[model samples]
Target chain A: MPNGLDKPETTLEKIERMDRRIVFLAIAITIILPLIWPLGLPIGVSPQVDDFHEAIESIPDGSVVLFPNDYDPASKAELYPMTVAILHHFFKEDRNLKVIGLGLFPAGPPLLQKAFEEVAVDQYGAEYGKDFVNLGYKEGREIVMASMGESIPQTFPTDFFGTSIDSLPIMQGIKNYSDIAILVNVSAGYPGTKEWVQQVVSVFDVLMVSGTTGVSAPEYYPYYNSGQLAGMLEGLKGAAEYETLIEEQGIATSGMDAQSLGHLVIILFIIAGNVLFILNKRNKNRDRGGRF
Target chain B: MWELLGIWIQVFLTLAIFSFLYRDNPFYKFAEHLFVGVATGYWVVLQIRNVLIPNLFQPLFGEFSDPWLVIPLFLGLVLFMRLSDKYSYMSRWGMAAVVGIFSGLAIFGFGGGDLIIQIRSNVMPFIDTEAVQAFTQKAGVITFLNILSNPIFIIGVICVLFYFFFSTEHTGALGVVSKIGIYLLMISFGASYGNTVMARISLFIDRAQFGIVNWIPTVIIGILMIIAFVVLAITGKVDPKKQF
Candidate 1:
């Protein structure tokens, strides 16, 4: 039998065996071009985000809004903008809401603090101790959450900076789930929205809204359907939709063009891959007796 | 100036990491190692500052030390014993306490929230009378598709569950149902994959914008990377093991 390498490489073979760098370069160009010149493509808002907005808006004035910024640096690209946008809504709204950023995971606290600095302080001139307090990362996942159900200050003795929660003006009168009006959860992975949903929301009957990473978004659908979650945001597209709803175009909004075009490129590659795979399969079958 | 400097450093790191797509090279290796070291150092400091010092040390040894805190302090020490192979067995006490507490907490949470609430919700109202009325009256522009959602949802849930029921062989009519279940699962998986792609692309867009807006530094470094890569390839210095 002739060696496969000795045979001339076909067009199908060339395309199939093409350098991975070409694929990467193609995706890179598609993404980069759109960043330079945005297409301004229209995007529709999903019902989940609508519910999320309404849930936030429905919070009574002076109610304590406890939001867990539960994302690591790896998820910052997707979840950080959502955190900033939500912070903007909380600070800008005339609700007199005491929005506290709680960090259940270690990576969550800094992102929350960064969002606060970027949106609440830099843009809206909101004070830290008065307007918001970042109850930085604690070890216990479910127990810590259950503890918060009892007492917020006890669960988180100190804020992110290690100042006592007792000292912070933001923690004044915010004792537990009963004191808190809403839970807006931003999650990347485990010990995240699900834990909060079970430990906090279900335990206390506390109304909640969640923004989760794309891969984990479907896990929350049942929660949303069950009315356990008042609203949900599924990833970057969800973030972009939220930006549109707020009418404040930021990074998420501008990135939509690239997001769309990049997806298109990926789809094209998928189609090409399927076609090449079919061709290869047919050739093998022809080489055989065309029997299964 | 510091802000700009920080952005430049981030850009350099991003480029260095992305260089791995070309081939495993010095820059990629350096960036990877640096990331591991820096992240470890940062996490260690954070744990000491935010957790250990505040939660354990201060509570036990601060001016108004709590005598009751010794129990936890001892347990924490037991956990540290895991570092030594001889004393690793002692770490189980701490591990047991952790697992027990979390399990106890999680059981309650899952029981009241997920098990009950989710099971009850699965009994979806196939057709809501109020929804039908609304659609008929055109009160909210509700479509028939809206009404069909619950039925489709219930069917999907049942089919997916059936697919997991390995006790029954997937044959004949059951095979058809199983096939449907698999199709639904694939569709769901496809959607999840699509969302993941969107997330990755979004990150790429953000970084691309950063590089474009800071073209001055990016261009200089990018060109240097290309030159170095070419020179190495010409000299046959490119590591064959690293190449795909």
Candidate 2:
């Protein structure tokens, strides 16, 4: 029994060396099940997301909300839902609010256009170049934002369609950051919330919120704590929370049950990994006659 | 019909990329190469459409008294000089201008906003009553959690700062403080990892919804992939012993 090979392999040993494909398969099934079969999961709203919702609510009527739909297709799973929900909330018939949609990332516009079509066009029947203006993709990120503080028209001379900004009714009197009420940066990081903080919020003192990927959420807490960021919506959870606030059971809301189960799987793995590691370590130490 | 074709293409690509989870194969490589190529092609076309024509060409040819714009235009063009050995020196002119401008911009932007403001804000009351009030504004257990968390925040900040202090050796009280800092860092890292896991799961869920909701194309692709894998295994192209 003192020699490891003399004894049968323990359950720990067998499970520890199990092929990782099993875990992938497990995760795939758990996620796919919820997608196929609808589970009406009750979602709780987080304080940060509540703050983000309130920030939007606080935007005065007739004021413009600059929504920077700044992310690529890769982030579509998380950020795309947030974009749809936010647009749905913004273009609500009662609000009478205008939004200037733009992005630093090139891929963002097309996706934003999709959101516009789905939420703004179909649901709200919002007119193009009147209710919302897409500035397309700007190449310069921080520099472009900083320049935007000077003049929005100068920063972007034309709309997404190459139509002159002067002609678009939405662009009328929207000179700079000062004219804008609040900016919601739906970002998947760099040249996003951070850039907006530096170039616009810090410099021009623009009120802003950010809906970012889960990974970037921790870093923005300090900004949220400092009151620099008005609100924070982090990842799919944030999207679901925002959807809840808007009273819309969208894609993110449906994905919640799956997200929770996947998290449970990870937690189980982490606990198992630590427990097995410690036990195996002790066994190995005993075999070595107490040598570390 | 076009929409159906698009969906089929998308499903094929998704399955091709997803097959990598099983093992490395030509399908994954093809999808990867196609993605990179398409992305590069998109960026080039976008840059020309957005930048060259609208910002530079349209302005230069359309204007007479635009001396200010000409300087930037010349500097941008000179950046290509690096390709030629004889004119390589001219590239530095463009590079220097860029570096200098960015450096100046960043100094003010980052220094004043992120660094100065963040550091200043961190130096707050250890037990922030206002933050407690904000938490309490919303009902439930979060209020109690916020009350406990308010003090730990400042402590976490201090301990983490202490851990990074290499000028003085960590001994006595310093060691104890830095040791706490290590724990705080581990907690932060664990949170980050948890978030990353959630992100990855969400991505998988998105794809699952895409495929499962549109079951026809997905079923077709899934069968094809299984067949291809079976064929590869039978042909001895992918040695199972070597792979997994």
Chain B TM-score, candidates in order = 0.91, 0.91
In model 1, residue pairs whose N, Cα or C atoms come closer than 3 Å (at least 3 residues apart or on different chains), thus clashing, are none
DockQ of 1: 0.75
Candidate 1, superposed: residue stretches over 4 Å from native: A1-6, A287-292, B83-87, B138-142, B239-242
User: Residues A104-206, candidate 1, lDDT per residue (tens digit)?
Assistant: 6777898899888998889888888898878889877777788888888876788898898888888877778888889999999888999999887887889
Q: Give the per-residue lDDT of model 2 (tens digit) for B1-244.
A: 9998999999999999998888888899999999999999999998888766666766677654455788988999899999999999999999999898778878888886789899888786667796578776875686777677757888898899999999999999999999999999999999898888888888888988899878999998899889988899899997544443
Candidate 1 docking classification: medium
TM of each candidate vs. truth = 0.95, 0.95
Q: What residue pairs clash in candidate 2, if any at all?
A: none
**Candidate 2 error regions (>4 Å):** A1-11, B63-67, B130-141, B241-244
Which candidate ranks first by DockQ, i.e. highest? 1
lDDT per residue as tens, model 1, B1-244: 9998987788888899899888888889999999899988988888888877877778778845667878887887899899999999999998899898888887888898899999998886888776687678774534666777788888888888889989989999888888899999999999888877877787777688779889998998888888988888889889544554
